[model samples]
Target: MNTTISKIHPKEIKKVTLGAGAISINEIIAVSRYDAEVLFSQDYRERVNLSRSVIEKFLDEERVIYGVTTGFGSNVTETISTEDAEVLQKNIIRSHAVSVGEPLEKEVVRAIQFMILVNLGNGFSGVKLATLELLRSLLNHQIIPFAPGEGSVAYLAIEAHMALVLMGEGKAWYNGELIPGNEALEKAGLQPVSLGCKEGLSLINGSTSVTAFASLALYNSIQAAKTADIAGAMSLEALKGTIKAFDPRIHSVKRHEEQAITARNIVKMLERSEIVEKYKDYRVQDALSLRCIPQAHGAVKKVLKDAEFTICNEMNSTSDNPIIIPEDQGDALMVGNFDGTFVGIYADTMAIAMANLAKVSERRLDRLVNYHVSELPNFLVAKPGLNNGYMIPQYTAAGLLNEIRVLVHPATVDNTPTSANQEDVVSFAYFAAKKAYQISKKLEYILGLELMAAVQALDFHQPLKPSPVSQKVYELIRSVVPTVEEDRYFYPDIQFITNLIHEGEILNTVELIIGKLDW
Candidate 1:
């Protein structure tokens, strides 16, 4: 139930994530600073040094710098005296902390904290060691800033995140209370930094906020897909849908790789099942969501894998620009490393595939809950008409599906060239990642509804049990959400399941009872 990832080697991120829920900041600390030396190249060192020179120039002459010596975004070129850069940074943080939606959940906020720390620990941002320590301390203490929800443009997630780091103006949590960053810093015995040369630009230039969305999205999407596969098979049993459609021979000919993989997994999950049958009125086929689980879910799998590769690379790589070149290195030319395009496209890919997966889930949930076709009780209620049963939960699920449809629009498609068009053509990955997360969070509740619904129907199967593996799943849900003999207030139960599912306790239960499955 705790579902903690014990040891995380950076390369084994996927497996670790499947087990632990999210990558913790502790993971960055696992790789010592020595690894940082090997990860950066001579060119990396040269760029960092060159970047340092630019910042040094701004400092030595008190000349106005675009972001550091002035303000940020749409006002980057305004000249500010060097004395004001620190105040500028603080002001930027305070004024830009204008996010609109509900505050991000703590786990989500923690994910953001980890990402920022990882980026800084790579030592590419020219961030002082002390700043990194502040981030680490905040993470370890469970104090998180309340990052607002607006300001996610396609090309970048600026205008908001910058306001906090530079100006120390935004809200942060110290110990547990939300307060201004400076107050939090003071409470935590930390010192804010000077917005030296490229520091402000470095702090707010990238998309860690968006990347946080991507990680949480990708993480939840992974669990949702798994939940879909398991629940799809369970629904197959509850509906008495023919297993022949998932037969190996049917998928073998198409060379549909995922089809084969899915078939194998379903077979594994359904092994020794008391419910599924080889012959049922010799029924020929299953519904598309059920029958096509391999294709739909597998597409998500492949896309998630690609997105993971990009995201992991981005997390480990340096994205700050005007990079410092070490004094010892001379062969490299200064260039831009702040581009988030790879993830921008990948985030779009994640949104598309994640929404599609949710679409598939909606279809299956419909089949499972709508008693007219389910041949089970209406909404899986034992005494229909008197008890509404799962009817309202379906409403909740449908709400999420509709929301995902709205968010499925690609975030990367719209981009405004910035930096006076000097840095034209942006990835807008931040929006892509954030929306991916938003859409995916809504999806958890939807999947929870369907999962609970399917198990409820399975409960009505008289004396039959699902596979041993799935019996555990059914019992797990059944334990929390008792079979609805007559519908009562079931929303709380469904909500509880959704939260537990999001916390990944159910997933860990699966891993504990059965063996871990592949993507």
Candidate 2:
């Protein structure tokens, strides 16, 4: 229910022009998170019209066009006259709008709208220019469709729910209030659009939902990855873990760029730390949780990079079926571009990578709170038994990690054929991307708990100051979440620090002091 548009001030609104070139992941983030306004280039308008002209010409000749003249899916053999084309389009939206569960966040719905523009703006999906304009108007006016969060195999159901809002037939959120779609559009000074030919099919087809979820998840995963390094560094310093394991020579010989980058990032964060310098040879080497920071976190970075590449490519590409080949006089070709296999596989891999990242952070959190291994006070509190501080927080991290583990099971591996098995072998990419998105959130909370515990453990070291970067990060967290003196309501503290991670406050604070962490 929290709308990104409410957070945007007039002066801060950014404009992203589509159809001029490939859409970048950052541009999607801009529109989704920052409430950036979207615009279409002149070239995009021409392309859309060209493709639409093809559809209109086919309709005039009464040529057979899937989803336009013929029925959809298993009903492809059923032919419809041109007079019934509009009814077929409207019927598809009505029948396919069957997604159920909690409504998705406004940001996600906004991202879906933006992806629709990118997918259809290339003159492939034969949607009318006016239809695309109506969608743009909805986004600019902050009228978000009330899309259900579940019940999607490869994006049809969710997208169909969203498309209903275009016809003023489903629910929508206008100015933070859920209301009838028609009223929402009326309040925004926009009228409902009339479906024409393939407009309805174009609106709901393709992997827009999967790509949108994956795009947002990729952005958050990258943020969590950076924060993991900072959290690991703080824990290592608190445990008085040796820094020799982070030596550049050791990582350079490993022959992985991300591994070396992570090693260097840790060294940079712990630079000139009295805690690390004084205990440089503490017990020869630290635990694997501390010593393998670079390798573990680096492997996550590699997965994140691959996911970014795949998801970004999906954002720019069209996934429409019976795609209009503009060069061949609008020859419609039935293809499997709508299959979300590429994005689904990468998104599943992203969840697995993030699970491993959280697992190691949970291990480090254990080292921070366990008195026997940490050498600090039990639970990092002065009076251990009476205070019972930071003990249950580790349990919370473990629970979150377990949830992420269960979610990492690839959704792509399980296929359920729909449309009477005529559409067999689905991608299930929507759930895959959705699972990855959920895991990113759990990962943030786990990292947040580790950060909170690390800061508390640092207090035990007293006057031995942490590195400048680590100290700044500690202070940044302390600004919102005060140090725990005894047992208290930890949920508020946990939630506050989690917000810090989600908002990039910790990563930004560290980066400002040490430049950007290596990708």
Candidate 3:
């Protein structure tokens, strides 16, 4: 399946329905990046009302509920009367919405909003139906809250910032202008929602922020994995590597699904190549980086698949602190679902996986540029000493790889207690997801460098021509970056190829020709 979301024109996409267990990465990307409208289903409204009625009955009976008729965290023992419930909810929003740091990207905030909306739509959070509609209004109107990138241990801090926007208390971007949340809501013909029956606690008590980050990173990493295969194939042609290593017969015995798929993709991409066929018996075996693209890249693929499974599961689940069970007659059950340990650990795993991908890509770039390994012109330039072609890009890749190494340290393993030890043991899943996002970006750039070098080396093969698929990739690359007969400014070349990778042009073009590769 092609999990990659293509960049669609904003006007082409229609309003999508969001609900529990139905939110997809494509849907999130559609609403967030493509500005598609969203609608809350009538089913969600009915469910919300049923859940709300339970809470209302409890309130009428003077029953104490955690974070509702009582204070939050360590203050849970302090009970409040019905008259003070609204004030408690509002105060939680006011005190908890203290996130500081650089503002999160618009796309991240949009995803967070979508996840929160979906979590509440699960009909277990005890928020009023009107409050859910208000969030839907924000999504449909393209009013994005200015959520900060830090101050989240679970998701309370960031979710508070998002909820504040609904209350018209935070900042938001509307019509491409950053304005007060109140003004944005007014301009969008929407009004701030009032807290009623656990609305404020329901709004901010979830793991939506880390879930959104992991979801976005999973999509990007899948694309990066496929691009790595394409770039690896190009490098194979440049080095005249043996396809014997990627033979299905060789991979079948190992029985690793991702490895076999990657080996099969390498074979398919390099099919009918005169270059690969010409050097049938020149060497016994290639080096590990060249010979084991399937092993390294395939391991990353497995890791991504695991993280995808974990994240999608998280998306379907309600991560709220105290879940309202309408089936149990609206009883609020306090649970630890809000803890983001699963997302944090899996996201950390993905960070290591992406870092490994970057490491191999950087080393492959080394192999392409070094004459000792590639047997191409020194520095891949005809006049090696004078025009240092692609020499510095390898160093750049190395530096990026070094940074990835540092980022791969498990954020989950290091936890700080928050909320007065009432919430002891925090999950830094947000930081883990953030680092994975950063690693994926650098991974794309590193692959771009490899593609640039591989194409340069393949040019030396002359009119021999590459595999039909490789020829298309080479031509597409040349369309943006010409053959480097001599080095002019190379940064522009890197930038263009990086853009190609990021824009999914290269992946889209190759998949168009060769069909979809195994994810």
Using lDDT as the measure, the top candidate is: 2
lDDT of each: 0.65, 0.90, 0.85
Model 3 segments beyond 4 Å from truth? 1-14
Q: Choose 1 or 2, whichever is better by TM-score.
A: 2
State the RMSD for candidate 3: 2.4
Estimate candidate 1's alpha-carbon lDDT, on a 0 to 1 scale. Answer: 0.65
* RMSD list, candidates in order: 6.0, 3.6, 2.4
lDDT of 2: 0.90
Q: In terms of TM-score, which candidate is stronger, 1 or 3?
A: 3
Q: How do the residues 1-519 of candidate 1 rate in per-residue lDDT, one tens digit apiece?
A: 222223332333321111122334224322221011113334434444454554565466764445555555556567777767666755554454555666766656666555655554454455544444555555554445666656555323343442364246567766668788778767766666655445555555565666666766776777777776777777777788777777788788877576688777777778777778533444677778777888788888878777777776666556654454444531122355666677777888888887888787777788887877788878887777888887787777778888888888887888787757765776777778888878777878878877888888887886876788778888888777787888578778878888867766676666676666555
Model 2, position 194: C-alpha lDDT score: 98
Q: Kindly list the per-residue Cα lDDT of model 3 for residues 361-448, writing each as its tens digit.
A: 8888999999987888888999988898889999999998888899899888987887688877788888888888788888889999
Q: Which candidate is the best by TM-score?
A: 2
Q: Write one digit per residue (lDDT tens) for candidate 2, span 1-519.
A: 111112222225498899777777667878887889999999999999999998899899998889989999999999989999999999999999888999999889999999999999989888999999999999999998988888999877898888898999799999989999999999999989999999999899999999999988988898899899999999999999999999898987888899999999999999999999999987788899999999999999998987887787778788998899888666888888888999999999999999999999999999999988989999988898889999999999989998999999999999788989998898999999999999999999999999999999998898999999989988988887787887889898899999988877898888889988887
Arranged by lDDT, best first: 2, 3, 1
